[model samples]
Target: MTLFRQIYSLLFSLFLLVVASLGYVQFTETQSFLTKQMESDLNNASTSLGLMLTPALEAGDTVAAETLVNVIFEGGYYNNIKLIWMVDGKQQEWNNPIKIDDVPQWFINLNLFKTIKKESTITSGWLQLAQLEITAHPGFGYHELWRIMSNTLIVFSLLFLVAIFTARLGLTWILKPLNALSEHAKKIAARQFGPDMPLPSTTELKDLVTAFNSMSAQLKHLFQSLDEEVGSLRKKNLTDPASGLPNRQYVVSRLNGWLSEPSSGALFLAKLDWLEEVHSKYGYQVRDETIRLLAEKLVQQLNEITPSVIARIAAFEFAFLVTDVEHDQISKYLQTLIRTINQEISKAGCKPNENFAIGVAERVGQMKVSDILAQADNALQKALKDNKTFHWFETTEQQIFTREQWRDNLSHAISNKKFKFRWQPIQFCNGDGVTQRELYCQLELGDKLTHAGQFMPYIELLSLGSLLDKCLIETVYEQKLLERNYEPLAINLTHQSLSDSQFHQWLNHFLRNAPQVERMCFEIPEAGVYSDLESCTRLCNIIRDNGAKFGIDHFGRQFGSMSYLQGLRPSYVKLDQSFAYYDEASHNSELCRAIINVAKGLDIQVIVTGIQEKAQLERFNELKTDAYQGFIAPPENIE
Candidate 1:
């Protein structure tokens, strides 16, 4: 029970005990007082009757004494009366009977008042003649006792109710601060620094609130400071000082990583033809200003076209790595870059001959980083020799599948639900057992099955992301039998899948009565969430309400703001492979620590993926990662 309820219960019990005890005491005292008063009245009536009868007997008026006795007996003050007369040494007695009326037997039995009788001697001239006896009825006493009890019960009941209502009001007023403190605690868990609560009249709770506010302020300041420091360090190391674009190392690393993956890629190199002439005519400072201005314009135009990495490789040469795009798209992006640079220089009143020369090389398969760089350089030399502003290197081999053919295959696969999944175990960092299975989807092409990397790009291009997600959900549901022996399943969703309203509606309906739904988890890429945050949050809320957990995969890659997590509150976040596998430099360490700390404050779990090295796992364990998913552990099959 809550503390408030406990307090109310205790107060109510104490009130009941006090009221009951007071009622009992008052009832007993009232009964005793009434009994004594009745006894006194009976004694006085008996004494007075005895005196009056003595006078009549002394005067030899027996008729008068008998008349007086009969009159007193018929008055009903006494239950019975007796008169004894002495004549010639023989005694004669008269006795009257009594009857009880109008009172219940139970009430009479409970009151149990005793009958009071008084005996008086009758004399003639100081000699006893007969004895006059009177007995009092107990009916009156029973009525008085019952009345006192009823009044006491009524009064005490009303008092008890009033006391409880007053106590409730007081307790609610006093505990208001405690309720605010509880809500404050929830906000802190969500990584929100809320306003301070009002101080309570209760001293102890006031002190607690003071301390809690102090701690919250400190944590908020710490997280902000870390964010600023990490951002500054990342920009300093990866960006060129003059042009504010990525450095040579950053671009090359990204190019190498993307080339190794199963995606089409292109490398574009552009050279400023009049850099030496500008430096000779003007000065080095003027040349530097021109290069910076040209680089800014080129980056602005490239970003408007598509997402690409821009870098300054040399004093006059710039490079870009555009992955997962067709050769035509790369050529268009290059043409836009050249046109934007020339327009910007013309606006600066520069000569028409002082322009940019660009070269492009496209890859469909795995190629060495050195080979890509050399091919792009050779193309640039050809462009300069041919007196052309742009040149392209074409491949000699024909592709295995045309664009239309791949689209047809993916569309058919999604429609027919011809997709298969392989389950891989994700283990806890503390050496505990596996927590869940990460699913990898595959498609069959004729006699052989094609992996996701080769076909997912096509599916994305066809706008079939939602359809693929639906297929995966159905596959997981079919694994109900396997779920009995293994952990739950975690599936990744594409941006299109999360943005589709119909998919969300279907998912909600599918899981309405589905057994073991809590054992399912849906994961979305951090970069994908930026596409439509409103839709993403709505989808996440739907999944969460249905007893499934939401997670962010490839986290910290976009280097975006984390304010979205406050609303999403995902169950866990998986670090990107690049962040987890790279060496722990000072900047990287600071960045990792900041991410973990922010997640911890939000009460969200952190998982580091791609920790293939034992040393890397140890380092992450020291960083308090909740789980790891990589080749360190062999993939365990679900069935």
Candidate 2:
């Protein structure tokens, strides 16, 4: 039960008891007064009657005595009375008829009415009669007492109800602030610090709320201090204290957060290329001071042009996180910043004796932090290849780098047993079809197996995409190939893997050694592939050459042209649902039909995705598409 309801019931019960007690007291007092009054009346009547009959009794007149007895028995003012008299030691009495059931029997019994015969000498100026007798009854007192008790009970009932209503209002009003303060304290405990709520009018309760608010505010301040301290500690651990620039760990964390946001902004990747030469020419203090001066110089320039987060990711490698700038200007700004920094360094009498190289790569859509970092790293490497100090990441160069890194890392992770695999069952159509599974790989730490979605982007950002792909491929072949029935482990390949000849050779060698693994299929994201088709074709050919198949995931939505179909032949082509869904019925439906037809002519099986209803299934079946995949398929929820 609720608190208020319990209190209301308790208060109501107490009120009833109090009212009953008061009613009983009032009723008893009124009944006592009425009883005394009735007794006095009886005494007065007996006295008056005794005086009236004294003369008759003394004369010994029977007729007069008989007349007097008749007058006493049928008195007009005493219709509800009873009379009794004794003459010569013989008794006579009369009672008026009373058949009253208006009062209860128990009540009447409690106030029992009984006759008491009393004899006294009637005195007339010191003279005595033969005898005078009277009978007493409490009949009139009982009736009058009943009426008074009934009135008191009614009054008591009304007063009880009034008190109950007042108690309810008063209790709730008193507890209002206490309840609010309780809720606020709970919210503070949960760390939901915002504005305080309105308090009640009661002084004590209001004071409690005030104290609670003050405590919450102080706790909030303490937490803020702890946060700042933690941030400072982290900086001290991974930063060059003199320049206030990030060390290696700081660079890694920034890259991680940057990649966390989906390819929304641009970051500039620059390498110091020659910090040792500068330090060697200058003394320890001058070198330290020089690095600081360079850091300040970069900060000033970056701030002046556009406010950006500049960090020293490595001992000599620094990074600039720029706002979303036009793609072409990214390289131009990299050139400008390096020239400006070098120019500033020369102004301080430091000759251009040390060679510096720079690389620039911007965020790609849905790219992981590690992957973007890798892109910059790749850019830096390409700068070395061209014998130039700076180079932007071109698709062709990034591919070669991706493949080599994939092979190196895949070999490392697998030999060291760092690869782990997870599977998600793929539902086929309308929640009634047999389920198929897609297995993916992740790197395992002690007691932890992180999902690919968490750190795959980082692999590519650090230009380690190929290594991740190799890890996935090796784990699938070693474990899932013979251990599980989930065929065609849907491993994602980095663009870098596609261009590495050595990795492709290793794949072929492995497949040749295990011929049954020949049925393996690889999936490459369509958007990244179509970004540069020539590289896409080369990558596809290499995989097809190894007796393995390839499919374009998230395909047919974009980069769907005659050339894409003509160049690559896969075992199955999963259709992007843009062509197959219901909401596109009016305008985009025909475009979908066109895609299915194109795939059909090319002998590619089309698997339309995102089917939601039975009607869509019937239409796709009519369209003659093979292997429908959607939430409606079997899972009834997953697309």
Candidate 3:
């Protein structure tokens, strides 16, 4: 039992025992007093009657003696009265039998007071005349004793009830602080640091509450400090101090990540044609100010396009990447940016034509980082050579589908449930086999199987992500894929599904009926999580409520603060593949370690992805990740 219950039970038992003991003592004492009182009255009555009847006996008046005995018997106090006298050597006797009235049989059967008899010799002037005897009836004594004991019991019962109520209130008041402390500890466990608890009047509880509050505050401060430190490190290592844009290393990492996937985007490299002249004529401060102004203008121009990265790659050059835009639109946007840059620079005291020369390289299919950068650099040289403001180095485009064809293909595939599923094992770093298998799927279009990379962009463009996710979940359920293995099956969730309330309700119902729901883990991309955190958090709660798990994919890819993890608290995070390429001495490696540390502090599992070799695996071993996934344990087609 709980401490409160134990204490309350003990107090109640003690009160019951006290009440019982006092009641027994009171009943016994009342019985003894009545017994004594009855005996004394019997003796006194016998003595007085003997004196009063002596005259009658001496007068030889049997009638007078009988009258005296009858009067005593009729008084109803005595149970029995008798008169005996000798006249002319003959004996006469008078007797009365006992009688009892209102007392109950059960009380009389208790025999609290026993039968008593007393006798006294009758005499006239110191001579004995006759014998007078009287026996006391215990009826009056039993009645008096029962009355006193019943009143005592009633009073004690009332007191006992009052005591129980008083104890209950007192215990609740005393234990209220303990309950508050427990709730406060739970909040701390959830990484929520709220206001301190009010101290109780009980000294011990007050001290305990004070200690808990102090510990909570300290933990809150510790996490805040860690978040701040991580933010500072990101700013120092990945961001350019001069222009407040991402540094070259950050952009390269991002580009490398994109290149690994079947994704297409354009890379723009811009060179300030007058930066050298301005620095030579003016000072470092003026050059830096001009660069910052240009960066600000670029941000303002491209603010509408998300999933874009702008970086300061060199002393006089800047680069940026944009995806999901048509080539024609990209060209027009670049022309507008070039014109805007010249106009803004003229205001900063630079010649308009001598402003910025830009180069553009189109990334189609999987290409090396060196190839894209070299192509952009060659375009930059061509622009400088031709004295043009900007030049586009367009590469051969892949066979593309129109939006109508994509919508038709995706809708048919989703509705027909024609998706092929593949499973990839995420193994433990200690080589203890697989922790779980990540699910990857492809759409079957006729005889061809199209990977998610080729179709997902279209799905997002068509706003069919929620429908596709629901289709995939239904397929998994119908296939009973969870029963194929004991390990959990991790599935990826799209941002649209997270935001869709209808999808949430459907998933909730599906999981409620799923016997192996615990064998499932839903993963959301890092971008999706940060894009709409409220929706993601709500979805996470629903998944967890159904006993499934939630994870973050492409972790560490975002440059935003990691503080969100405190609230989201996913079961695990899959590090973005770029971290696998970073060497131990690289600043990205340090940032990776910081990420691992913060995740570990929250007890979240860290799994590094894209580990192609044992050396890459060993590189992450220093970072103390919980698991790894990639070519080391390549994905397998689930049969």
Top of the candidates by lDDT: 3
Clashes of 1: 0
Question: Which residue pairs clash in candidate 3?
Answer: none
Better of 1 and 2 by lDDT: 1
> With candidate 1 superimposed using the best TM-score fit, by how many Å does residue 379's alpha carbon deviate from the native?
5.3
Between prediction 2 and prediction 3, the one with superior lDDT is 3
Which pairs of residues collide in candidate 1?
Answer: none
lDDT of 1 by residue, 1-639 (tens): 999999999999999889878887887788788778878978888877887777676776878987877777666667767777654343434444443465566777764677788887776665777777777877667777777777788888888888999999999888888988988988876687767777777888888999889978887777676566556655766677778887775676566456544567589888876776677778888888877887888777887776777888888888988765655567678778777877866755666535567788887556878888888988888888887887887678565577789888888887787887676788888888888878887888899877776676666766878888987788667655336545777888977888899998999998787888887888988877876889999899899999988899877655457767777889999876656545566446666777776676677889887666688788776678899887676555444
Q: Which runs in model 1 stand beyond 4 Å of their true positions?
A: 44-139, 198-208, 252-269, 272-300, 323-335, 348-411, 481-486, 501-513, 563-567, 584-603, 618-621, 634-639
Model 2 misplacement above 4 A: 1-26, 54-225, 242-245, 253-267, 272-309, 314-316, 321-357, 361-375, 381-389, 396-639
State in Å the error of residue 350, model 3: 5.3
Which 10 successive residues of model 3 have the least lDDT summed? 90-99
Reference-based lDDT, residue 32, model 2: 67
TM-scores of all predicted structures: 0.81, 0.42, 0.82
Residue-wise C-alpha lDDT for candidate 3, range 245-337, written one tens digit per residue: 999998888887777765556899999868777788798998898889878888877755435788998998888787655555466668767
| Every model: Cα RMSD to truth | 4.7, 23.2, 4.7
